[model samples]
Target: MKVTVIVPARYGSTRFPGKPLANILNKPMIQHVYENVSASTLVDEVIVATDDERIKSVVEGFNGHCFLTSKEHATGTDRIAEVARNLSTDIVVNVQGDEPLISAELIETLIKPFQDDEKLQMATLKSKIKNQEDVTNPNVVKVITNKNNHAVYFSRSTIPYNREKIEVDYFKHIGVYAYRKSFLFDYINLPESILEKAESLEQLRAIENGHSIYVSEVSNELIGVDSPEDIEKVEKFLKAR
Candidate 1:
């Protein structure tokens, strides 16, 4: 099946303006994300979907494919769906543009579940929470999965509460997601979910709407740029590599 990776970028971020174009190690953060996603062997095409012309121009400047999406989209998934709707492909991957450290290998890992399970409608990555502090950190979204590896729930609060002190492990949610092109449309049509709104997480909508999301556990910890401070963290990682 053909897989396309779409990175949704917007210049207007309430926390950090022009975040997509933020500089990281001398290259635009979007450029770093685009180039890495392009390196994924499973991806047949890689494109940037943005509402800003400035973002579009920069993407083209780097010789990357970019599509200008509607500014009305409230979420990054919506921005990606606008571009995916016109593409003739089987699967669409939404890789956050802010994650300059996202590796091609991780992208490949996220796509593997679909190859193994044709029935999987949506999939995303997660990593075992190694640090005790991370388990309680609300900023670090945690996810729990069932025996089938399907996500049971995503929450800002620590899950599996361990009220009885069992051997349960916590997993921090990775933002990258893969969706069957048909399911992508289905998701957008579903009404805004209570859980989604409460947690400020888009993935919760699928769960609330009675759809399953496969959560693949990966080892790599990718730093997603949410604010200016994160750029320094990314630069340090990149420089060391």
Candidate 2:
């Protein structure tokens, strides 16, 4: 299946305004995200979906493809749906604009499930949570999958409960996803479910609606820049690398 990676960027971040254009070691943040996704072997095209002209100019200056979207979007998924309407690709991957260190290998891994399963409608990545804090933290979304590796539920609370300390793995849901192009409208149009509203994890809508979302286990660490405090760490990491 042909895949197109779309990075939804907006300048009105409550925590960090003009975040997409913020420089990391002199290069813009959106450029870093674009470069990472563009490096993926699985994606055929990469587009930055933004409502601001400043973001459009930054992306265009780097010779990256960008689309101007409506500023009234309530969520990133809705923002990408507009861009998906204009594209003809078989698969659409939503790559977060804040994830400058997002793994290209992980992006490639996300697209792998679609290659063999025609029934798969959506897919996302998960990494093993090593500590009790991350497992319990509401900020870190947890994903529980069925025997066939399809997501059963997604929540902000620790899943499975570890009732007996049995040897089981706890996975934290990564904030990247790939969806079948045909299901874009269906996926977005579905009314917000109780699980989704409660957890604020949109993937729950797919689970609540009885849609199977394949989960790909990956080892790559995702570093996202969400606040001003994270910039120095990212810059230092980038400079060292």
Candidate 3:
């Protein structure tokens, strides 16, 4: 199956304007994300979808592929859907531009579910929540999965509320996602669900509509760049490696 990775980058961000162009270890953040996705042996192609000329220029400066998308997109998924609509690939991987630390192995793992289950429409990564602080922090989206490893729900609030005090592992939702090309187009057209709007999470729309999202457990910790402060943390991680 042919797979393509599209990184959505926009110059205007509320938390950190021009974040995709932010420098980390002297290299643009988007470039780091692009290179990481390119390292995936399963990905046949990688493209940067953006609405700004500056971001496109930077991507091309690194000899990376880029496509200009609409500036009116409310979310990265919308931008990716527009690009996926024109592509003929079997699977489209939406790798967030801010995730400079995303591993190629994780991308490979996200796409592997498709090879085994032809019925699977979407998949994403999840990691164990190591601390109580992150579990309670609303900024950290939490997810719970069924016995089959399919996502039961995604919420900002801690789920499966520990009333019984039984030992349970809490998983934080990783933003990277893989979807079938056809499903991407269909998903974009679906009206935003009440749950999705309430949580400000697009993935909830799929869950509300009865579509199953396979959750894959991964060991690597992903640091997504949300603000200028996050750059230092990412830099420290890079320097350690």
Candidate 4:
């Protein structure tokens, strides 16, 4: 099955305007994400799905493929879905444009399972929470999975409630995801669910709709660029490397 990695970028950001185009070590941030994902041997194609012409131009400037979509999209999934609809790929991986330190190897790992499990419709990554305080942080979304690594629930509050205060392991959800072409459409078409609205998590839409999300535990030690300060961190890492 063919795999396509689409990095969804939007120029309008309330916190960091023109974030995708932000320069990191003299290169645009989107370029870093696109180049890293492109290095993945598992993927057949990489595209930047964006709503801004400026973003499109920057992507094209580096000879990378990019397509413009409707600006009204509420989420990156919606934007990538619009682009994937016209493609002939079987699997679509959503790689965030803000991840300058995104790993190509992890992208391969994200989609490789599709070859073995034909019934698997979706998959994502999870990291064990080493910091106890992060388990209680609202910004840190917690996920609980079943014995088969299928997600049971994802919430900002402490999952499984640890009411007994016993030692327990927690995993934080990573936003990246891969979906079968058919299931991707099925997901985008479904109305937002109550759990999704309550948690403000888009992935919950799939879980609430009775779809299982298989998660792969991965230790991804990288900083995601969210603002101008983040760029400095990315640059420092690159310089150190």
Index of the highest-TM-score prediction: 3
- The residue pairs found clashing in candidate 3 are none
Give a tens-digit lDDT track for model 4, residues 1-241.
Answer: 8999999998988889999999998999999999999998888999999999999999999999999999899899999999999999999999999988888888877887788899999999888988889889998889999999899999999987878889889999888899999999999999999999998999999999899999888887567877788888889999999
Q: After superposition, how far is residue 23 of candidate 1 from its true place, in Å?
A: 1.2
TM-scores, each model vs. reference: 0.97, 0.96, 0.98, 0.97
**Model 4, residue pairs in steric clash:** none
RMSD of each: 1.0, 1.2, 0.7, 1.1
Residue 182 Cα positional deviation in candidate 2, in Å, after optimal superposition:
0.6
Best by lDDT: 3
Candidate 2 lDDT trough over 10 residues, lowest sum: 220-229
lDDT of 1 by residue, 4-94 (tens): 9999988998999999999987899999999998998899999999989999999999999999889899898999999998899999999
Assess the local accuracy of residue 184 in candidate 1 as a C-alpha lDDT between 0 and 100.
Answer: 98
Score candidate 3 by lDDT: 0.94
Score candidate 4 by lDDT. 0.91
RMSD of 2: 1.2
Give the better candidate number (1 or 4) by TM-score.
1
Tens-digit lDDT string for candidate 3 (100-207): 999899999899999999988999989999988999899999999999999999999998699999998999999999999988888888999999999999999999
Q: Rank the candidates by lDDT, best first.
A: 3, 1, 4, 2
